[model samples]
Target: MDVYIRSVNVGRPRPGIEPRGRDTAIDKRPVASVEVRDPGPKRGGLGSGVVEDDVVARRHHGGSRQAVYAVAREELDWWAAEVGRDLHDGVFGENLTTVGLDVDAAVVGERWRVGTALLEVSGPRIPCATFAAWMGERGWVRRFTERGRTGAYLSVVQPGRISRGDPVEVVSRPAGGLTVPEVFRGLTGDLDLARRVLDAGILDDRDHATLERKVARRTPTDH
Candidate 1:
């Protein structure tokens, strides 16, 4: 199954929305490229720029990927109603807020073709304090994590221009027993689920390494 973007909406900080402790919300604006940083303090988190392939290193980091998203068109009306407004002029922080596809089901390593662009599912985003601050809900981050509705991230496998209303189709589904939601749960310190993802063999080398490390941390000696 594949998902397609019906529209692309961007959002910036609104009036009276102060940047609370550890919160960084900027005014909504159009960007040529959206950066996805790893947010790790070490490993010079900015490993390499996906758009530029430049190795400008930094100690304090967050992963940044050029924002490309897919949403179903039919759901826009519902989303607008829930948000209490129309989706134009950028209100949602999503660079690409989409409507038709099941956004939550896309798994890592899965590839989708949008127009001439090819995107590979990379990882699930970790909700941050900024998101909570934006929503004015103190526990929003925890709640979102608990709900496990965090959106999937995609890395440009074959770079090409993408625009609103582009049709998206799944070109390939990588061999893996676990689904996208399973991977997201695993990243949130769910060891048993992580084990399932590993045993299922859906994880690539990097993911496999990370999961093995987690398993080792949980089990000091081989079982």
Candidate 2:
């Protein structure tokens, strides 16, 4: 399917803990490269795409990379609709806003072409306090985590410049029956769903191990 960027969003760094309290005006910036790293510091390599030795994924809340998510396209729209605003209003903190892509359905290892850049769906972002703060609600993070619509994380498969209004197309679908949504649910306290994905056996080794461990921890007998 043809994908396009609906908007390019970036939050002017705020001074305090207030999520929407931005002291500076929002500005557009080109997406250098999207990344998905294991929220855990124990597993520190880039999850699915190109990574340079110097580029270390920022860690939050004690090595939880999942907390800070970059939402894409339709999912961004959904987030905006939930807050009664557009993504450009600085609600999502997304550096690159995209459209015309079913980001939730994209599985890990899948590649998407946007202009000269190619991005792969690496994993589902884990929602955090920043997300709740952005939405201006106390329980927004929990709600998102429970709902499993945290959006997909992407890694740069091909280095190229990306801008707003660029068209994106899915060039690959990796071998998997579970979608990004399924994986999100699996990670966020849903062992049954994780088990289903494991049984399907379509996930890559990394995903499979992660899902299995999560499931085993949550529902030992099933694994």
TM-scores for every candidate against the unseen true structure: 0.65, 0.66
Summing lDDT over every window of 10 consecutive residues in candidate 2, give the lowest-scoring window: 47-56
Best by TM-score: 2
* TM-score of candidate 1 on Cα atoms, chains taken together: 0.65
Residue clash pairs of candidate 2: 3-168, 73-98
lDDT (CA) per prediction:
0.53, 0.55
Clashes of each: 20, 2
Q: Write the per-residue lDDT of candidate 1 for residues 1-223, one digit (tens) a residue.
A: 3355544443422445534443232223343433332222224443332332222222221233323333333334544565576644223344445556666677667877765677767666566544556565557677667767556666667666555556778788876545566777986788888787777665546558978888879976756
Q: Best lDDT goes to which candidate?
A: 2
Count backbone overlaps in model 2: 2
Alpha carbon deviation, residue 64, candidate 2 (Å): 14
Candidate 2, after superposition: displacement of residue 113 in Å? 0.9
